[model samples]
Target: MALLSPGRLAALHQMGATETRVLQDKPSDSYERGYAEDVDHIIPSPTLFDSLRDQHLVPDDMPAISQCATHLELLEVFHSLRNRVIQSRYLDNAFNIHPSKRIVYHRKHRRQKKVGKELRDTGFEGRREEKWKYYLNIATARFEQWIQGIDTAMNDLEIPPCGRKVLPPLDVLVVWHAFLLNPADFKEYCLKKRLQHVQKIIFPWREIHEAIDSTTWRFTVPADQAGWILQTTLLEPDLLHTLTEDSHINYLARDLLRNLSESRWYNLAANLRQANDRQSAFMQTIHAAINNQIEHRPLVENVQRQCIFVDKMHAHRWIRSPAVQGTLTRAVDKYENFLELFRLYPNKFLVPTLDVDLVWHTHQCSAELYRGFVVDRVGRFINHEDNISRGTLDTGFTSTEEWYQLRFGEQYQVCLCWYCEAILSAVEEEEVKDGGSWEAVDVEEIVERVGEEVEFCRDLEISRQKGRRLPRWKHGAGV
Candidate 1:
């Protein structure tokens, strides 16, 4: 025979009284309540042994024999006799069903409704009952497992330092761990659950820094959750400072800064002093002189009015200051030479004395020259009086005699003033018509013309060897 512990006996007696009161005060309308109370006593009977067994609190090695069976039957009788007490305490008060079990119940009810409609429509009711039983068994098993899980989790809860005391809610611990795993999802769950006034514990900065540096830190949090973490904790500072100080960090700091600032992480801006400083310096140098002369003129005037204004004589004296005159002259000369070269070959050269080949390699000559000269020439050529378009010509005469014979006639004498003058004037007119634009002419045409001229000169040389002496040619003079 097994003896009950004092505590277990007390619990059983308490349950008895609670069930007794529930039965005595039971309303006539609640047949299910009475039925449930009877079922509780019949199946997992609410006796001390039954309660111990259901709770898994019974020790092993207890014999299931005649005396034990007698004890179990007697315990079942006691549970029925004390039904009202158990009903009041556990049956009436507690839902006596897990939430997962409740969900299963609703699901089964829906499935049953669907199956009932189908059976009525088809007149096939044979499998309906079987399906219901199957679903019921599955639901029952799942409910039991869910309850077991809950019990195990409860058992794992740390005992208070002082005997049995109320522990923190299990949901709170769940939320904390969920936040550890994924703060973003946890935050959403909290919002959906309407858990108001939940005070989140702020993690220590060093711990957070370690988490970030570990390379395994989860970045799955939603933007809002990240914003919350940054706002409530020191995460923003740690992240901003880490990225700011890291030499290997990419040029994405600006983007990060923008995101942080937009999210109201204003403190991060403080750590970006160096970046801001560099940007300020660049802006100042790029637009400073213009800004000073125009936008900030009032301030400039104020400074000039307040400070000593040096006259031209004083400026000259300052310019001729022995301390800097030599350096200044050398710098000015270097700058002047540079400007001249830039004007002459604006695209090809930056510095006058630098080797031409170096500048040619450094800059594109055609593009620069076109930009500086051709663009300006377009406007000038449109306004010019001489309508002569640019033309290309090539000549390859070994002697002046060949050139004269080609342009004038082979028999033409220098004494023919009209012809000679016309030829000279035509050459002058051609030069004037060109507007001095080198790019306007066709280079290919010029090369072809030069090749033809070279061949003609060779023919002329052969003719001279054959005793065909061409006269010496001149423009507007004796031939």
Candidate 2:
């Protein structure tokens, strides 16, 4: 930057290039910046200045830019002709200008190197706590790899091994297991550590507090056994064992099953979705048999029970909801059944009584019909409050990638993918994404158009308010 032409430097500054500035006082050429101290350079290249001026059309801001470089006279005019040519080519891709193809998009992101590749010390006579982390990393990595369907630890339950030293407490490891497993839902540190509340059954409070007191000497598990051990503990609880299935236990088991590279869940999810498409109820009932394979039944039951309770309480509001149009009466046909079942079995029953309008569009006609319905009806529901299909309108188009980009800008594409990912049947879109384009709508262009529309709408709002026409600039200043 110091060697750039005065005009070029000022133009960059105007276009928001970062420059080192002296806060207290402007530093002189002699003032030492640590990074510059070791560097060596050649004499100013006069040809660069001439070449830059000749080949590249100089910007209008060059005069002002030349003044900005007044203090940088001693700065060498740097760069080879090729480098300068490449550099000067993209100056116009500044703010408020739509980014150009000339500007680099999709850079290869740099990531920090992973840990635990280094060999651990042979002896235990070291910083036990610090060494514990080496093993913790191994355990975490194995579980993560397992989750991602990579070759991982042998025991589905255990953490991987590290060096010869004390390990992190079982409590913390269990929390990590839950976190790495349920990346969503259990996001908060406090919420995750809440699972540490379960650790008391395996390692008592006295032990946990002692580990806290002397973190360095804490007893750690083998990296491989770390994950497996938690599952063993989950199996150990007699009280939870009494239940046919427990929610917490099911959740932990689900995480363990996810990392099982040998497991057929992913293949089944894809295949079962096909079976589900042909006959939704058949697949829905068969779901119970499938969850038993992964021991995930309780988690599903727990979520369903919760939704059922909420729906039961809010029956009047949504049973004949203004938010849903079709078959309002038919959707809650089970309302009478629900009342009878509740009388007999209390809270043990759930009658699927909502989202009737938000029908699985695929089931309605065919995949094509669903896509058409999304593009037409669901898209129209965007700004219309009176329109039914609230649940469908909100969650449906999101899977298609249109609603997200329309409501939020292109930057939110990642967030939208994460949000509607579970429901997205990428039928064709998956291939489109792999080919480097997923969006049907140009989000940035849409945002600009929407902004214009909003500004136009403001005129109506302004007209409703009282205002007097006045001079563009009022004169009470100097007078």
Best by TM-score: 2
**Model 1 scores what on Cα lDDT?**
0.26
Write model 2 residue lDDT over 1-479, tens digit each, in one string. Answer: 12123553344333221112221122223222222223222111122223223211322211111111110121111111112222321211210112223322343445744333434344322222222222222233322222222112213423322211112333233323223222223233325433322111111212222222110112334444444433332111111121114443333233222223223353345434433222322222223333343343223232223333233323222111111111222222222232233334333312222322112210121122222333453342111111224576445434424422343333122211111111122212333555744445343343333333222222211221223111111122100
lDDT of prediction 2: 0.25
How does candidate 2 fare on TM-score?
0.14
lDDT of each: 0.26, 0.25
The TM-score of predicted model 1 comes to 0.11
- Quick one: best lDDT, which candidate? 1
Estimated TM-score per prediction? 0.11, 0.14
State residue 427's C-alpha deviation in candidate 2, in Å: 26
CA error at residue 128 for candidate 1, angstroms: 55
- How do the residues 1-479 of candidate 1 rate in per-residue lDDT, one tens digit apiece? 01123443344345434533443343222122222123221211113123223211222121212112222222222222222222222211121211121112223565464322212233223322222222122222222222233333334553212111211111111112212222233344446645332212221111221122111112123345344333332122122122234333313243332332223222333535654443433222222222222432332232222112112212122111111212222333333333333344433312122121112211111122212332353222111111122231111112223433444343212221112222223333344668854444443443333333222222222233244432221223211
Q: After superposition, how far is residue 205 of candidate 1 from its true place, in Å?
A: 52
